[model samples]
Target chain A: MPGVVVVGQVARDLVLVVDRVPEEGGSTDVRERQELLGGKGANQAVACRRLGAEVELLGVVGADRAGEDVLAQAAADGIGVGGVLRREGVPTALLVDVVGPPGVRRLLEDVAPAALLTAEDVRSRAGLLQDAGAVLVQLQQPGPAVVEALAAARGALVVADGAPADARTRRRVLDAADVVRADGSEAEALVGWAPRGVPETVRAARELLEQGPRVVALAAGDADVVAWADGHVVLPHLGEDPVDPTGAGDAFVGALAVALLRGEDPRTAAWWAAAVAAQVVGTAGGRPHLDPDRLRETVRRHRGA
Target chain B: MPGVVVVGQVARDLVLVVDRVPEEGGSTDVRERQELLGGKGANQAVACRRLGAEVELLGVVGADRAGEDVLAQAAADGIGVGGVLRREGVPTALLVDVVGPPGVRRLLEDVAPAALLTAEDVRSRAGLLQDAGAVLVQLQQPGPAVVEALAAARGALVVADGAPADARTRRRVLDAADVVRADGSEAEALVGWAPRGVPETVRAARELLEQGPRVVALAAGDADVVAWADGHVVLPHLGEDPVDPTGAGDAFVGALAVALLRGEDPRTAAWWAAAVAAQVVGTAGGRPHLDPDRLRETVRRHRGA
Candidate 1:
C-alpha cells in the first residue's frame, strides 16, 4: 500500500522507574532505567508500517549519537527517513521520564523547532508524497512548517493528528485536513465541549465539523469514539488493560490512515483503528507491534471484515 | 598538640570531572548541574562547624561518599565526625561536576551542594571517649554495623548527627559531649562520608601519627577542626577569597570543638586545620588543610585569601 507519510518530532525517551517521588529535599533510588526511541512522528510511522502500510517519516535529528540510533532503527524497520535533515551542532531532543506511582513525570522537556523539514527537504521528497494515499501530521515539531507541507501535498488525503494543539494551532491546521483525529481533551480544548454519551458525541462531532475537516474522529478511551463525517458511526473500544497508554493515540491515527488508504470506509477504518489501539495499549513502552498475523487476525475476528 | 580527631575513611583523592568522562552511548548534553556536597557524613558535619573546629559528624557513608567528603574533609579541616565508619555501598565518591566554562559557572555550583550533610541515625550516642573535646558522627547508615556506643567518658567529647540511615534501623549511639548536625542526604542514605581531599589528608596524617584519639572530628569546606583522645584540638582557616566555598565545612566542628573548647590545644586544633588546607589549595573544597597559621596565611593571601 502507498500508506501514510508522517511528519513531526523524533526524540529519545529516557525512561526510569523510580521507587518513589523524591521528597521535596530528599532522594529516592531508581529501580530501572531505559532509553527508548520515540517521537510522535516515529511512533505514528511505526504504527502505520506495522499495520501493513509503507511509511515515510520527516523530522530533524542532530548528528549526535542519538540521531544515529534513530536512523539505524528506522532503517531496520524499513521506514524511510530521507526527508530528515541532519542539523550540525544541534543536539537530538530528549524526554527525561520518571515512570512510577505518579504515572509519568516528565523532566527537561524541549522541542528543537529547527527539526521540521525545510522547504528543500520537502521538495526533494515531493514525488514520494504525491503518490501517497494519506499524509499524517503531528504537532510535536514546528506547527507552521508541517501545515505548509501538508498544504503542498495536493493529491494526498491529509490527516492531522490534533492531539498536541492549542486553539491557534487548531485554527491554523484543521481546515487543511481531510480527516482529523483528536483525543477528547483536544476536542474539549478546541471547541469547549465534552462529548460523553452517544448524543453528546454527535454534538461534539457536529462542533468539530464546523472546524472544516470532512471526517472528525474523537477517541475517548474506553468510553467510545464518535466519528461523524458523511454519517454517524459509534466505534466503542474493546476493553484491554493497557500497560502504558503512551503512543496509543498515535497508533489509532496511523492505523486509521492505513485503513482509509486501502479504500475502507471511515466506519470500517475507525473500527480497525480501535483494534490496533487496543493491541498497542496492552503492551508496554508504547510498543506498536504485537504480532502482524495476530493483529490482523484479531481485527478480522472482532470487526468481521 | 592534642590535634583534631578525624573519624572517617582516610583514603586517596580521585577527581573525575563530568566533561572529562565518557557518557553512556557516546554523545550527551552538559546540563548546568552543581558540584554536589557528595559525602553524606562529611558534608553534614563539616557544614555544621565551618567557622572553626567545633564540629563532629557520625555514620558510615561508605568508601565513596564517606571517604571523599568525610575522612579527607575532616583531616583537612580538623573537625571530627566521631567514629565515622567506612564501609562500601558505593565507590569512593567523585563529584562529577560539569563545571561551566570559566567565568559564570562558579555561582551556580556554590548553592547546589552547600546544604548537604550526613548524620548517624543507626548508632547510639552514649559515653565520651577519653578527653574528647567534641564527638561527631553521621547516619550514612551502612549495612553490617561497625559503629557502637562508647561507654567511657574520661571527660571525652561526643556529638552525634542523627541523620536518617537504614529504614528498619537498630539504634547504635556514641554519647557524652558537644554538637550534632544532619542534613538531607544523610537523612536519606542514613550514612555519609568526607569528600575527596579530606580523607587523603587524614590518611597522610594517620599514616604519620603513631598514637591518636578515640573521638573523631570531620570538617568540610573551610571549617577547621581537631578531636581529643577524648579531647580534640582546634585549627583555624581564617582566610578569604571564598567566592563559592559556601558552607566552609559547616562552621560547626571548627567553631565549637576546636576553637571554643578552651582545654584543647590550638596548634593542630580544628581551627588551624582548614586554615592549613586553605594555604595549600586556597579554597575549602580544594584540598586538605595542614601546617601552622603563618604558612597557611602566607599561601591563602597568595591564592587571594
Candidate 2:
C-alpha cells in the first residue's frame, strides 16, 4: 500500500509529573516519571500507521541508544524507517516535559541531530514520496530540508503542519501545501493577528487560504474551523475528557491526509480528523491506539445523520 | 597505585527542578531539567577517583546505550570499569529525582540490570579487592552480591554505606564491615531507636559497635559522630553553604577509606572524611571536582591544629 510519507523531527521525551511549579530557586517533588517516544514527525507517522495507513518516516536521530530505540519502536509499529538517518557524534533530541495536574505541561527541548538534518538528507529520500498517496511535512525540521521534501512531493496531496518555523519557511510551506493545519496560536502567528472566536477564526483561515493552500484548518481548544475558497465549516470537539493533548494536532493532520487521500470531501475529512484528534487526547503520549473499523462505523453514522 | 574497589549500582539521573511538591492530584511546572550520572556505588567510586585513589567499580549495567555511556564516563574519570558487567536484554538503572527546595528531594528508581547482578558476579572480581587499600560496598545491590563482595575484601579495610536494605542484609553487612556509616534515619532503623542529639547519636554509635562493626559513623545534617572500640569523636561542619548534599555521605565514606588506608587514627580519618564531605555538599551530584594537592593540604592543616 503506497500510503503517506512524513518528514519531521524525532525525539525521546522524559516526562515528570509534578503538582505545582516551584519558585525560581526552590525544587518540587515528582509524583511519577516515564520516558516515551515523541517528536512531531515520528508522532504523525505513528498516527498515520495507527489510523490504518502505511507510513514512511523521514528524519534524523543521533547515533546513540535513543536513536536505536526510536528506530526500533517505529519499525515495531509498522512505520518504514528506511529514510531515518543516524548522524554520528550528535546526541538524539531530548524533550523533557513536566506535566502537572489537569493536563498542564511545560517542555524543554534539546534538538541535537535534528539540526544536522540537511536538504541533501531530505532529497535522498525523495523517492519515497513519489508514489505516496499523500505527503505530510511538519515545520520542525530545517527550513531548506522541509522545502526540499515539499518540492519532491509534487503529484501527491501535500499536507503541512504548522510546527514552530522561520517566517520564510512558513510562507514557503503555505505556498506549497494543498492543505495546511494550524492551532489557533499558530494561525495567529502566521497571519500576524489573534482571532477571537469562531467568526474571527474563519476570517483568519480565509486570509490564510489566499496564501495558496486549497484548505486552511484552524483548531481552537474545543472548536475547529476549516476554510476553502468558497466557504468554511465549524466543527465541535468529541467532548471526551482529554488525558493529554500533546500530539492531537499531529493526529489531526495525519488523519486529514488519509481522508483526503481517500477522496473524501474536505468537510468530511475535517470531521474525521477531529474524531481522530479527540481519541488521541484521551491517551498518554502522542500516538493513540486506533481501531479502523470503529472509525469507519463512526464516519458512516455521521454521514447518515 | 592500588586504591579502592567500589561495588554497587550505577544509574542515569533525570533531575527535574520544581518549586514545591504539588498536591496529590495537582500538577506543577518544571523550572529546569538535567541528565546526570548518579548511583551510590558509582558516586563513591568517582569520589575516590577524584580524591586521587585508583578506583575500580564492580557493578552491572544493561547492555544498552545507557550502559555504554556510563562505562565511558567511568573510564574518562579514571575509574577502572573492567569489573563492571554488561548484561544483555536489560536496561541500565535510571533514577528520576524531583528536587524541591534545598533539602527535599524524591527519588523514583528503576533498578533493572542492577537487580540482576548475582553473588557470583562479585566473587568473580575478588582478585581486584585483594591488594586494594580499602573496599567500599553500598547496600543498593542484591543482598547476596553485597555479602559476597564484603567476603572477597577480607584483607582490605571494608567500608559499608547503609542504603535501603532488609534487616538481615543490614546485619550481614555490619558483621562484615570494618567501618560502617549511616545517616540519622538509617541508624535509627537499624538500632530500633532514633538518636535525637549528639550525645544520643554517640551512645547509639557505641551500641552499634556491639553489633560487630569495628567502627560506626553517624552523620547528622551539620554534625557527624564516629565511634570506635576505645572512644568516639564529634566533628563539626566546614561552615560553608551547601548547594546539594545528594552524595556527601558517599564522599565521606570514600575519603574515610582513603584516610584509614594511609594509617590515620580513626578520629583523624573521621575529620578528613568530614572535610571531603563538606566539599561535596557544595557541588551538584555525588562526585565533586577535587584537587589532590588541596585535599592533602587540608588534611595536614587539620592534623597540625
Q: Which tens-of-lDDT digit does each residue in B1-305 have in candidate 1?
A: 23333233222221211232122212223343222333434543444344344544444445543255546656566555455455555433333222222211121111111122223322342332344454443333332232433223334454444443443331334223344433322322222343334444344223212222333444433342344333443343555543223233433334334443545353334444354334423333434333345654653554353
lDDT (Cα, tens digit) per residue for candidate 2, span A1-305: 45898988877877666676555334455555566777888888888888788998888898988889888888999999998888887777776665665466666556754444699998888888777889998865678888888889988889888744677788788878999888765776666678888888888888888889998888765798888888877877762676666777888888888888888788888878877877777765656588776666665665454
lDDT of 2 by residue, B1-305 (tens): 45889988877766656676555323455555566667787888887888778899888888987788888888988889998889888777776666666545656555754445689988888898786778898875777888788888988889988743677777777788898888765777656688888988988889889988888899765688998999898887762666566777888888888878778889888888878877777764545687666666765775566
> What RMSD, rounded to one decimal, does every model reach?
12.7, 5.0
| Fnat for each predicted structure, in order | 0.00, 0.00
lDDT top scorer: 2
lDDT of 1 by residue, A1-305 (tens): 66678877787765545544443213344455445677778888888888777888877888876788777788788888886777887767665444444334323333455555565666666776777778887754455566566766668888887654455566756677778776765666545666675677677777778778777787654544546566766666653564455567888888888888888888778777777777876654576555767666776777677
